[model samples]
Target: QGVVDPLGGINTLWPLFGIGNQMLASMALILGTVVLFKMKKQRYAWVTILPTVWLFITSMTAGWQKIFHEKPSIGFLAQANKFRKGLDEGVIIAPAKSVADMQTIVFSNQINAALCAFFMLVAVTMLISAFFVIRRALRSDLPTTHESVVTLRNKEVRHV
Candidate 1:
């Protein structure tokens, strides 16, 4: 689900590839927004951050649900667990539920792990970049500094 399908259609291309890259996509958007804030104005930053916030919230919520999801047919981990349980019980499980299926499960898990790591690294880079931007902004605003004045507060930036 795209969260708001009316705005745009949901993308199924990733599911076919066994990758859910929504979080990565959203984090990229957020990283771009952060960059825009630094290159543009702090006031504009506040406004631009709204969509990023929504994206972040939805991405995180969806990721959490997918990892701990209850549905066997939906979540990958759940599906794998169910298949394993079925195999252990010697019951017919998931279509072929055999060594091949186990291999696939392990492969899918590794892919998921790589995706998570990639996303985490990106998020950390964005956070660090944003931190530096914020620190620079704060440094320039010290009372002793004689730099061209720029207000940090949104209310004040509105007037600027």
Candidate 2:
């Protein structure tokens, strides 16, 4: 059996992983903003709204770069194209042990690029859904989902 390299292709994987993680954080912040709106506290919603917007923008930008940038190190598609060119010329490029390794690298990069695109799509969908929910909450007098606060009377308290 051949031993697998634990760190192989990590350069391509790291950006995709980072984007996925940030997308999740962005989703949570969007949910927080929506909850604040539902509670009729639109003013305080900016606390979460700012982070949500920042995360969304940054994550999307990163994902876009990973998918489309020209540099092989920065873009998965670019890396894939580079390897494919090498494969077409029947040359084994650096970091690729053989023609088969070059083929695997090309396919791996393509998969990574697709994954990055998928993450971006999910993030956009979530942001759009949150926008509608927040708009509805602001325009309508929706009942709050939180429990009412109850104050205890001094007479109801027993001395230990």
Candidate 3:
């Protein structure tokens, strides 16, 4: 018999997980450049390409949080100060800063949340598209279609 599947779950999830996240990003860069060179249907390519840029920016901000131990932005000082106050009543005085800094931290958090939501939407869409493509491929039978009497395309032939 044929070889048993070595990666059952991965084979199923690869397109949705792999392509929708990492592979799509790489493809976006390559395909975007190719589309620009070909001068073809660029609108579709831009839709895929723009998200990679957003992902890059978001990853930069989020990655810093994961990689380093740093104080919150000045905008978040109020919340940070609030926590510090609770920790030691006599210590950890809040830094003097403009209200704008607090607003900036709050705004950054909001921006971060919004970016995550948008990327999730993109991933879902990519998953659906992948499913449809796989479904079509599974349903298609070129071997049988060639034997059929009906023509798939009806364009008139032009002989040079």
Model 2 vs. true fold: TM: 0.85
lDDT of candidate model 2 versus the reference: 0.81
Which portions of model 3 miss their true places by more than 4 Å? 1-23, 26-96, 143-160
Tens-place lDDT digits, model 1, residues 18-133: 33365566666666655555444456666557776776666656655445567854554666577567656766544444655554553454344345545645655776676686
- Candidate lDDT values, in order: 0.52, 0.81, 0.41
Tens-place lDDT per residue, model 3, 28-71, is 55444343324333345566557755764454344333223245
**Predicted structure with the largest lDDT when compared to the true one:** 2
Candidate 1, poorest ten consecutive residues by summed lDDT: 4-13
By lDDT, the candidates rank as 2, 1, 3
Q: What is candidate 2's CA lDDT for residue 99?
A: 77
Judging by TM-score, tell me the better candidate of 1 and 2. 2
Best TM-score goes to which candidate?
Answer: 2
Residue 106, model 1: Cα distance from true site in angstroms: 5.2
Clashes (N, CA, C under 3 Å) per candidate: 0, 0, 2
Q: What TM-score against the true fold does each predicted structure earn? A: 0.60, 0.85, 0.35
lDDT of 3 at 34: 42
